[model samples]
Target: MTTRFLRSSSVLIGLAVCGILPQLHAQSSPPTEWVDPDTGHRVVQLSTEPGSESLYFNLNPFTPDGRKMVITSPDGISLVDLATRSVEKIVSGRPHIIMVGRKTGQIYYVDSKTENGATSRLVCSIDPATKAVREILKLERGQSVSTVNADETLLGGTFTERTDWDTNSYFEGGPNRRTEARTADQQRDSKGQLMVERLDKHYPMGLFFHNIATGETKSVNRGTDWLGHLQFSPTDPDLLMFCHEGPWHKVDRIWTIRSDGSDLKLIHKRTMIMEIAGHEFWSADGKSIWYDLQTPRGEDFWVAGYEVSSGVRTQYHLQRDEWSVHFNVSPGLTFFSGDGGDAKMVARAENGKWLYLFRPELLADRSDGNLDTKGLIRTGVFHAEKLVNMGKHNYALEPNAMFSPDMKWLIFRSNMSGATQAYAVELEKGDAK
Candidate 1:
């Protein structure tokens, strides 16, 4: 089932044709809204609690059988049956013991808790059906978990600390031991042989892969660099995609590497924009990736995509004043969350109130044999303006709205209930908006 979509010339192309100051169409559009089936109401409030500040979802829950949505909560991991709205707790907040696997019909996470500023870590698992708990690893001193990848096989965590020092013994100078510690008075003054204690420790800052079936564990070395996000290739477990502190520089870049710690490659690097600043996702087919790149200005940078195979990239530009639309659409376009395989839907808010939906096929003709910059800007603006007036509809505030493995259901995290909870929407040809 298909519908005719629109394609508008980019603000850039329109200007380039006239050949002026480059007329950069650096603006982006809002998200496309998915209409709620029941009450002509655009929003399907899934959470029962509302107006609760800080009640938000970080990751989109995964569906084991594409029928039930599994998610990690502050307490632990939980599963919600998409068809029935039945939620069963896999594990409660043990704070430092989140579960992190699900191949055997369960949920998993590594729990980390801070007590008086120190962290304790643990890896745990839970049954989706009966809600029973099982401990995988107990928190050892100085270890903290960060995120669990799509494959339960991998887990990311941090091991870090700091040190302090004392100041004295430079001006007075003189004891035999002071000579050994401070050297000559000139040397002491020049080198500042001040009595200082060296505080050194190694910290973990990455995702690790644990073989649940084999009991084998391996770590991804991000060294002393900041590891922002990590994902295993959907097609190959031996391959991985991650974002880290740019090599030799302070900026952040998306990279790919062989899981065995070889053949590391910078899949995409931005020169003008350095810090990634937010979350990113790999395409369902692992052919492309997406993330938001900020400019020197305070506005959120454009959300951009990179094609893994062709070396072609696409970016959606929105004005800093259009932050509402860009933020809303950024996540939807980055990931897929629907039952149908032929077409995908992405929604973003233009002004916090209005939303837009875009279909890739809508601008297929403008591909230019690749994802051209002109095509992206033109199509994005066209969709953003049209979606704003789609009556009243509420898209998921969280960027995730993906489908189960079988594409039989739509799984998304929602805060319509005030508290963020997992919910599902059925997909059909008629449902496309």
Candidate 2:
């Protein structure tokens, strides 16, 4: 499929989501195009690859200029030039790292050995222009969720000793490493049964800060338990966040620290009323941490935000109609989007996965109850064109949808054609949208 269009139904957002908003219709700039009834935005598909398209959620797929895209597969790393619609293979095998420098436009990826093997991992930076390769950091431990600072002078990394099967975690309790141990080392256990049973040791996961210019890698902090979802603050280059990557109710899901490793502090702790907060992301300006708030049993679904400096929090509660796997805010900070509602659509179906946008400003007077607002809409529903067992594994394609840095477009991955490829949808302007 080169491109297929989806028109908004004359659905009432208030009726579907319990009086969340008034009746709204899609206002498409191109009259023939589909306008999202929720946000009144246009949606477009940017790719139709025949094989498979994969992307990491923490990393922004767009390069410095948004002219190129980066993706990976079992075959290796591939680059897509958005303007020319071309694909270039950068590496042969799946690397340990895949990232794009925000300011320098340097393509950074890693080549590594298996976790049980005694080999070093190489973190490489490639100049997209010259295709020159530079090995920046070499270490015995593997890195996950590594990202660059806003200015690109430094890189933040999370190094965990847990032997994981898949890094792109969208679900839990499938082919569990601890229970389904493969190696002799995995059969044994240490203090912790599950993690130590999977690996020889349960060393504390280390969070590192690497200076690009100085060629120095410093250990900022390390934890003995599960830790991941590490990300650098967009506005504050020296600050970063990590979490105990487990059930939200079992652990404090959000924490923040500095590059020098000092001032290590927890960002959010669950209270009796608000018992969980995970799937966290920084605000556009880095002033607050935005996340979904819920109870232990997954009731009281809410889109929440916390001001980092003032310790004040604001929440916009959505009706308990359906649940979304993740929620992301636009760079403009005017709307928030969620996925996974209707479950009937297959790879080609867009039923349960709709592009839901909610406005927080309209709920200014409310804090912790069902939000009564008008800026709610379902702009689009996403179902992959085709589904494939990537790498011949149990994993299937997941649409890690995100807004562009400029917030003018939304980026998502799917296998609508034969292959998985990156796709973009144009957004309407502030006034007309």
Candidate 3:
């Protein structure tokens, strides 16, 4: 059971009593409540587990049926059934190892446990309702699956030897040294410094893909020293996406290749005008790509999309005053949300941190774009609130929050009651109030 305790408004009230400020005199932490400005109605919370949390911000983590959401917690990989308001535990696995089948609605995960006293990792698919496990691919000791195709027939994994390294050798927030440590193919300088190796130009470290039906696996041969952030488009069985996996300005960040390992195309190439762009994702229809772009050192923030077939680039520039490194579009492209505070999601210029949602129509809006200064989010909801455990403020939940399949709720992770839990804020109908 969650350790219940008395709600404390005394701390903020004491500040007011000390003549610090009168504004927080009545400002105890409010419950999850936000009224729709359009209808004057309020949303409701769904998930209740104390330590519950959902998938990464970029990954949707929703099953095909839309009735359940995959969540990982101290317990295991579980499902939040929106219809019944119940959580069903599926299997025990590490967070970020779970996947929802795009076509079959099956749950897939990397099963790493001991069998007959021998430990191994297996890429397995499951029937969430029946808890039936089917092993599709067996991984090497260091290999881990990161992405699967729309049909779940093609999958990709990354293998590296630098799992143990002083990752912050270069800059404060540079990418981890996920590349292999072997220097067999590298030439040392006169000073005995290792030359920079570009794996995308030549694949040495294994960036491999496996075909489940044919039992064939091969290295696609297009990656950097470290490859990560793999994603398969829901509309194309042959289309797969991967990243160079490092800080911006290092190299081109995103690339798309066919499942058969042909037509390897660069999605976003950094240029002088637009210095860097990454955090790539597929649009709902798979006809285009969605990503965030900014000038060097995190300025000129812009949310951009590129049409895959037409080669069209559309950018909605946010005011230079506001900033966020990561941006995610809703399933229907109705609105997009931006967040900062994580290492990869920092706001280089902002004083504090926030998670803001914006209507698509208001993205480039010069009139009311400054939500932080305007007060109460414009275009849609302005949720500057955070959820975290009470005593341990630093153990704040990553509100990898996103819109539900039907766009009726804003789902996120919170530890407000002392445990990191997944919670949802419902979007009521226009006339509900």
Candidate 4:
């Protein structure tokens, strides 16, 4: 499908203009088009694909340490160190669930290996310093641990299976002749349960916690909600957060619980048939959780932050562009990608644009800094556009804005010549002073 963006000057100013005062609407200026200030250009393009071929790039949450990026390679879970920018193969096969510790730089993932010719996926880890991948524990074949703590001490994961039943004999009517409209995975009973022939088996899909320090793994034993997108609390490593995609045919979930499998609390729920803000996250102080939800008509997306104690939810609305604005992926956030809701970096799906930086101070308060949030907002940077409906889209942009450890240089990835590469833009000299 085609995506469109709105770039009216007023809207761009509306989003980018957040400060001490909250304006009711934006005033018109020339459509603030997205241009690299240094080169004076519009549209930072990446990749050499013919015409809008989807290019896949992953953001490494653990890259801050300059050690490794957790990536899925043909040789299994691989760690690419930015210092060397080299991909090191740590294990082989589909290590489906992979996580990297932001503080300790430890990498964890799921590896399915052949033991006596039988295959199973297990929770695994790789130490960047030693370049070693080791198995921690083995669960049922389909179970995979998806998140790990920064210290590599806690792990969370999920497992799923299908329960099927026969339709011909169970029905009140005589044996049915045809089952035309059913795939094995699609057929379900009246109560939303799978129709399986055995009639006695229950598919126990659940979430679990692992004490990496003790090697003692405990099954969470929650209901059949498909649990995933797990992470440990930054402040209290013993706490865990996760999203549950209820039943095989349901939407996403947001939840938080303790590592020892106590106090399972459902944070958010929706009846929609989409991922919702299912790629969920929590705030640094464990006071809130954040997630994304697509608009009801799928016209746009919204980012949400939920206060853990008060259960107050706040939604950040993103202004949409009327012109085709194709978005294939969600902008992956940085340190906040895990349990703590603080997100440092975010990626743009359209044109592979990136806005990477960490501003813990700004997020702590309500002051929206130099970012324009109203127009073409991705990864917290706003884009202002002109022509209410089309050309010269205004963008409240911080082109190539990445922060140093102390929020110094705004490093960004640019492709002026159509080759994706890295570049850094120093904040206006006096801005820091």
TM-score ranking of the models? 3, 2, 1, 4
To one decimal, what is the Cα RMSD in angstroms of model 2 from the true structure? 11.9
State, as a TM-score between 0 and 1, how close model 4 is to the true structure: 0.53
**Please, what are the lDDT tens digits per residue for candidate 4 over residues 305-363?**
66666666655445332111121112232321110111111222332222322211112
Best first by lDDT, ranked? 3, 2, 4, 1
Candidate 3 — what's its lDDT?
Answer: 0.59
Model 3, residue 198: displacement in angstroms?
12
lDDT of 3 by residue, 1-433 (tens): 1101112346546776898755543456434333344334343345555555677666657888788888776646788776656778887745245478888778777766687999877888888888888888877744667777788888776665444335322211112111234331221111122213323323334567788899898876543356667778878877887777655566678888776668888887766743878878887778888777776546566777777887766676665433444566776677776544432233444332444565555433465654453322223222222221112212223455577787766666655445555665544332221
RMSD of each: 17.5, 11.9, 10.6, 15.6
The Cα local distance difference test for each model comes to 0.42, 0.58, 0.59, 0.43
Indicate which candidate wins on TM-score: 3
**Residues 1-433, model 2: lDDT tens digits:** 1222332343443355865334333332212223444444554444433443535555656787877877665566677766555678776765644567777778777676556666667778888778898877775545543677888778777765546646322212211111223432223222134433333334567888888889887885776756667778877889888776654556677889889998787876676753788778887688888877775435566667778787766666665432455667776567676543333211222234444445555333443457653333212222221111112111134456576665556566654333455655555422212
lDDT of 2: 0.58
Cα-based RMSD of candidate 4: 15.6
Q: For residues 277-386, what per-residue lDDT tens digits would candidate 1 score against the true structure?
A: 33455665566666554553244435566677766666655443333312322223532221110001112223333232333322335556665564232223222222
Clashing pairs in 3: 51-420, 52-420, 52-421, 52-422, 200-223, 388-415
